[model samples]
Target chain A: DAGITQSPRHKVTETGTPVTLRCHQTENHRYMYWYRQDPGHGLRLIHYSYGVKDTDKGEVSDGYSVSRSKTEDFLLTLESATSSQTSVYFCAISESPGTSRYNEQFFGPGTRLTVL
Target chain B: AQTVTQSQPEMSVQEAETVTLSCTYDTSESDYYLFWYKQPPSRQMILVIRQEAYKQQNATENRFSVNFQKAAKSFSLKISDSQLGDAAMYFCDRTGNTPLVFGKGTRLSVIA
Candidate 1:
């Protein structure tokens, strides 16, 4: 798991509720990413942070917001959860992008969110 | 935008046999990276192999190898001596200046 941990491994929430998932890393990597996995879709990046307070949106960034106040922690917030937002979320960390020799992303176990 | 395509949605192979998973991508960048990641029932993403667009030689790791055709915009993974543990969901992805764009994924089943 590359010293990465995601809180709330499983959560069942109702629609219109607010949900926040936390990702913590001990590796102190410079990059952190939030991705969602669903049927028919392998993994789609929701958001990523290159450095503290430097975050960017991904292809599927709508309805999702991210914050990285610290290097080790990256948080994903669903302002108002919806049924479509129910999926398995994964957190990944990497020392750098493709330029680094250790460019591979290390993923956490994952957090399963179910919205009714 | 970079897009990865995995043509096969599902494939099955007998134990000790060999199987090839096909993946193709559309990228305009000359310098990029391609990767194959595996996710078993545990749901943990594991890196199987990677290929640099600048490298002409294929990348191999033990029984796992890749056939990278930079000009053809194709990268395929070849697994030799398949085992039960090899059964999993495999995703193909490419990265350039932005985050990795992944394929829909292919499910592999290994039968003994």
Candidate 2:
């Protein structure tokens, strides 16, 4: 499929442990984002990258970290996992041309992370 | 900051019938985009339809269409001849330089 794939569809980790979620895209998009979804808060952005090695934080970047060392892969790391970090994480990519509105985002199946 | 709102938490429609899900948003930027995403039990976020802010024409994809009221800052989704496959959580989103801001989502139930 010409889409994005997220590793470890489901994971359970202990508190204070370091966990990393990987997002790989075959579409070669310029923009990649990490978002977490909870029950009533909809989906909140954690981090996003405009290009390779160019990234910025979103509204919810407190305990999360992200890296976009290459164009095809974006990794999100939980420095120290907390129970509050337990949520469904999603990776999205957009192929917006120069104007940055050329295409909509494509999301992966999402990784269900449970912090114990 | 932009915010998307889906007032109806849940909705139900009979098969072959029509149903509309309401979405409201607040954005100061005039040039942006709106989208509807569907997440089924499989947990895959699928793009149902999209609308460019500058365009006046409504976007339609198969049985899915959008009634976009830009002046009102309201965008609602209409499903014509709803099917069982339409049962999923539908989310309205607004996008700009920032990542897409999504609504809480409305879970739709298709009764056959």
Candidate 3:
């Protein structure tokens, strides 16, 4: 179990409405990531941040946007919710990618989001 | 881009028995990392095992072990003395310098 927490463990929003999910970490890790899990898709990265204000798009980042203003918090926002975006979202933290200490990422419990 | 493939969509094993889950990946990078993750009904992702490409010896953690064949581009997970807690969706992943690429996943059912 990591010291990571996602706010609004379960959310249901209507279509075309704005939605935001928050990921907060107490480990002070350097890297944080947002991932979405679906039935067929194991887990797809939506966005990642190396440091505060530094973020990169992942394989599926079309409808999602992210912001990391501080080391402990990362936010994922959907401007307009869609049915396709309904899935379980997970937050991960790692100290370093190449280093042995942080080679493996620690995942949060996850947040289930539903859109109608 | 790197890709991970889990051939078996589902597997079953009796309690106290051993079961193996197959995984294969495609990548051009010589040095990388491979991992097996387990997600239970609670939807919490847990790390089962990890294997470094440079290490010839397979990695093991308690009852979980990996059979990594670098030349064959295959990394399989073996669970010994399976328990009810072992029943879950297992995912195989690979990563170099980029983000991890995961397979579709294999659901394991532990039958008593």
Instruction: State which candidate has the highest DockQ.
Output: 1
TM-score of chain B of each: 0.98, 0.98, 0.98
lDDT for residue A99 in candidate 2, whole number 0-100 = 29
Docking class of 2: medium
Candidate 1, lDDT over the whole model: 0.94
Provide the lowest-lDDT 10-residue window in model 1 chain A: A95-104
Writing each residue's lDDT as its tens digit, candidate 2 over A1-116 gives 44899998999999999999999999989989899999988888899998999999998999999899899999999999999999999999988832255668889889999999
Q: Candidate 1 regions off by >4 Å? A: none
lDDT values, one for every candidate: 0.94, 0.91, 0.93
lDDT of 3 by residue, A1-116 (tens): 57999998999999999999999999999899999999988999999998999999988999999999999999999999999999999999988863354678889989999999
Taking the candidates in order, what DockQ does each have? 0.78, 0.58, 0.68
For all predicted structures, in order, the TM-scores are 0.98, 0.97, 0.97
Candidate 1 colliding pairs: none
**Model 3: fraction of the reference interface contacts it also forms:** 0.57
Give stretches of model 3 more than 4 Å off: A98-101
Q: Model 3 clash tally?
A: 0
Candidate 1 residue-wise lDDT, A34-113, digit = tens:
99999998899999999999999998999999999999999999999999999999999999886556778999999999
**Where does candidate 2 chain A have its weakest 10-residue lDDT segment?**
A96-105
